[model samples]
Target: MDIETCLDSRIIHIKSDIELIDVKGQFISLAAPIRLTGQLRLTDDLRQILACIDNEVEKLTLQIGVDEAGRGPLLGSVNVAAAILPSAWSGLIEMQTLVNTPLSILTDSKQLSEKKRDKLYPLVQQNALGYVVAEIPAAVIDQINILQATMLGMRLCTEALLVAVAEQIANDTSSTSYNLQAQVLFDGNRCPELDYLKLSSFGISESSIDCQAWVKGDARHTSIAAASILAKVSRDQTMYHLDSLHPQYSIAKHKGYPTRVHMEAIKMYGVLPEHRRSFAPVRRVLENK
Candidate 1:
């Protein structure tokens, strides 16, 4: 993103079309010097120059946004994450910059296909800090219901992200009081009540920002989408493991969902230890068995 500046400290915005060439043929004022180049991608250069436009207003503001996926699904774990991105104050895009890269397709969790999620999982693993993903087993999910399970996962993510961000700042600041400020954002109608765990901050209390939960947050927030991919991949792996542990239940085929095939398997083979007894269908299957 280099800017051509022979005239130092001055910014130039070339808006009008000008023929840049060997201008011996064109009349020029002595005040204006001639400029020529063999090849110049001025437009391309301008894009980098534009990207360099960063917000200088805010200082060290971290926005920890949380979201989850697979909560409604009868299969995978309810995935959640609290992504600590350098707020708009930094002008740094979390995932959109990789438009042409392998992860260019990172977007809303629902918008992402199973295939896309699988592809982005590795990308997330490599990049995110405190990428703590908790797997909510069917037994536990059924015990607490999907909503509770999603909350549990979100709590775990919040705890982990807060710890991680604090540690990062502490290490960077050498234990100095840096006035660390954070705002929590989640893709839900309300804020996450992390009553289940004892949350602590280095010096600051958990500041709850209006989560601004969009209906399609995964598509809206790059951080949420990254969290979705992490949760989806982890849940799939858990399901695969369950398949190995209880092959007769065909956990792999249905991914622990109440599919017709899964129901038939339950009816024929009986429920496994992992089956959620609290869930009505599983309870019915057990009673019949």
Candidate 2:
């Protein structure tokens, strides 16, 4: 019997005498059975079947998730993080499974307390397949605008992550040689225009990497969650350092966010170089002065 297949988004529709297997979020239909005398062969339809299989493979392939912190802050730098987890390791790590000592918990960084995030930062760095943290300071944010600066930070971190992955493959003798073609999942709807790096020595083409944007990806994807934790902790540490220089701003307490205390502090201490002049409150203060 001749078989026909159609796919709509995540759903797959098939018509054939053979019973079709059910897949989650996919629908399949079977047509009337037809007896055949010899081995059945698929000609033109083979291409379609192969295409569907390829789609499935891509869906299951590894992904590098990117996220940012300090974008909305009135002070400090914006931190972007790109992280890729080892395919062999699941997202969850048992309390004492890793290392001899107990480690911090893993989840969306926003869900964790400051102490918890501080502990998990080192654990994430140790276990990540490859990760990069890129920061764009307030001066740069003021010059290029926050949105553009954020996109730039994400692009830089992603490129760094690719470099790290390449280096890891070169250094690990036990690692099997494989083509790199992982999708980058951006946390927000906007995806940065990332340039491809051609590793001529390794014979890797520019098309090896793919990019995708997923809204609220940090909450939905494990890799994005990992990236979030790294970015947040790094930015917080930077804010703490800044606080040492300008103790009046109390940056460590508010972490540069525009809380009531922060606003009052800004009014009393005035603007500093670390404050984002492009932000409305800072801009207003500058304009008034």
Candidate 3:
């Protein structure tokens, strides 16, 4: 259901009182919406999406969720974050709607279409608060291993939020600083550092490391979805910017991930400074070409 939900250029909407009988059934407005499957499926409209979201948010008043994106891809970085809402959650939703984004599609990061991401990138940027993203360069990934890299990235994102919230509060930059806290909810059980570094690294700081990993975090977790959007938009923008330097390779097309376009670029141009020679495909290309 989360996978199929549209997030690119289509705003999902259902009436306040309309009872959603099924996907194909009428989206007739009613007095009170019937909640089914913990999610509502309906048309693409701002008010409708907001209502559905509000229904979800209203149920889970206080909780933090975490998720990751861009892991399978060979290029760019692994991105993740932990998020919890303040009293401003409603305002955040309203601000998301008011961001002049008609096709404001918010869903799991990879679920979004390329066109939709390009369109709503700015909106996500405009609306997100206490957002964090970590760019795990190829070198670090090679050294630490992918699993550890992923965990490290998530940890960094959480720390980033803590840092930002602390910064804002210290300087009184804005009202969002008060909401920052150490509590976190991750999507999986195993932490790379927890297994790798264990409690040894935390020392006295163990109490500050409060997070739990879940099974299908990005799908069911709102904070994870929020993190997913933050990471997705950030990495996409990075790809767009890098496209300028590697125009012939079409970095923007593959977004630094290994694709036919990227492979061909490697074969044609050899390795550039940013190319991850540590990757087998990149190494093979160098060996063969």
Return the top candidate by TM-score: 2
TM-score attained by model 3: 0.59
- What's the best-to-worst order under lDDT? 2, 1, 3
Q: Write the per-residue lDDT of candidate 3 for residues 1-289, one digit (tens) a residue.
A: 1112235532222111213211123332322231111111222221221222211222112234456666666665555544443323322233453233332455456677777766655554434433444566555555556676677666545543443333323332222212222456676776424321322222213444556665665555545556666667766776777788779889877877788878777788777755656678877776876
Model 2 bad stretches (over 4 Å): 1-62, 90-104, 167-178, 197-206
Q: What digit string (tens of lDDT, one per residue) describes model 2 on residues 1-289? A: 2222222321111122222212233433322111111111122221122122321232224467789998888998888887766543323343222333333356668888998999888777666655667667777677768897788778766755554444434433233444556578888998987644334344244566678787877666777877898899988988999989998888889999999989898888898888898899989988887
| Candidate topping lDDT | 2
- Model 2 lowest lDDT segment of ten: 32-41
Whose lDDT is higher: candidate 2's or candidate 3's? 2
2 against 3, candidate with superior TM-score: 2
lDDT of 1 by residue, 34-101 (tens): 11111112232222221211322123444555676566544445555555432221112354554555
